[model samples]
Target chain A: MQKIEAVIQPSKLDAVKDALLEVGIEGMTILEARGHGRQKGHTEFYRGREYTVDLLPKIKLEMVVPDELVEKAVQAIVSSARTGKIGDGKIFLSKIDEAIRIRNDERGASAL
Target chain B: MQKIEAVIQPSKLDAVKDALLEVGIEGMTILEARGHGRQKGHTEFYRGREYTVDLLPKIKLEMVVPDELVEKAVQAIVSSARTGKIGDGKIFLSKIDEAIRIRNDERGASAL
Candidate 1:
């Protein structure tokens, strides 16, 4: 299965959730994250850079879905999370070896 | 590189973190999570199930490390986080194509 991790603006959570649910994704794990976006570098070590380092409050949405739904899920996130601004955030894709549900030891897709 | 995600008990955060640091992993992203574990299924649809649905507080630790560190990192997490109980949580392994530091656009291993 493909795991989709989307780091997005905090304000866009509800809209993104609605969009995902509309596309048939119901379960997801949401996390509050600090986004290392561009901020002013305060020390000499990073002073010369074109941009500074800053951490913005970001919402990370994670879910593992069947491989076939990867592209569709990505589109749903990007379209809903984009703000035409630099801090719109990013999405990372990866492959999951297996998934086991702790409740009943259910494995694979059924567990998901 | 591999992305190691451990959904562990909130109380084990400190110990798990120390374990990672001892193994040379310094950077990580932490998120607060709610874990769905066996609780009394309160609704009709889930009432007859062997277990119920309840959300427990969990801490999700995320980091991308060099391929060689995957095994060590997993061991560090599993060893420190296990409580010999059902809610100790689970660890997931995935392959990351690339990692980019948003602060300055540093990419790949350098970013990680």
Candidate 2:
């Protein structure tokens, strides 16, 4: 199995989720993160003082799918998340050795 | 080496942290999440309306560990996280090709 992790703009989360669901991908985990990527830091005014905010708010979506679905899932995310902007985000693919459902001991793709 | 990701109940966060610390696994990332598992959710009244909330608040803990520490780390989490309840949560192990610390150029297990 492959685990697809996408670090995306917060504003693009709903679109990405809906896109994945449209492709028959239902189970997913979402997390809010602070990312310092290639995008340069920008100065912000806080309490009348300028502060450089290096880390920007990001949303991370994670899901484990059968090997066959990896490409489709990636395409779904790319199509829905792209904004022609610097912080459009990136997707990472990783190999998963096993998956076990904690509820009933279901394993492998079925557990996913 | 492996990456250990645990989806646990919010109330069990402290115990899991202490358990991991006792085993010398200090670096971890925590994310707030909503999970829908075998544990049936309850109903709540919001704005004077009843809602069947199938998804419950959860805490996701993630960390990369050396190969030798994988077993030990998993044991620490299981021992501390188990509450003999339906929603005790689960742990997932995945292979990591590389890990690079964003702050520096450090790589591999050291970056962890």
Q: Score the docking of each candidate (DockQ).
A: 0.20, 0.33
Mark the regions of model 2 whose C-alpha exceeds 4 Å error after superposition: A39-53, B15-29, B35-56, B66-88, B96-112
Off by over 4 Å in 1: A38-53, B1-4, B8-31, B34-56, B61-91, B95-112
What is the C-alpha lDDT profile of model 1 across B15-99, one tens digit per residue? 9999999999999999888544432343212223432234446788889999888878877887888766566666666778888
How high is each candidate's TM-score?
0.56, 0.68
Output DockQ, candidate 1: 0.20
**Complex DockQ, candidate 2:** 0.33
Whole-model lDDT, model 1: 0.73
lDDT of 2 by residue, B1-112 (tens): 6888888767789999999999999999998886544323555333465434334567889999998898788778877877665666667788877889899999998988
lDDT of each: 0.73, 0.77
What does TM-score give for chain A of every model? 0.83, 0.88
TM-score for the A chain of candidate 1: 0.83
lDDT of 2 by residue, A41-90 (tens): 76533346543556667788888888999999999999999988677789
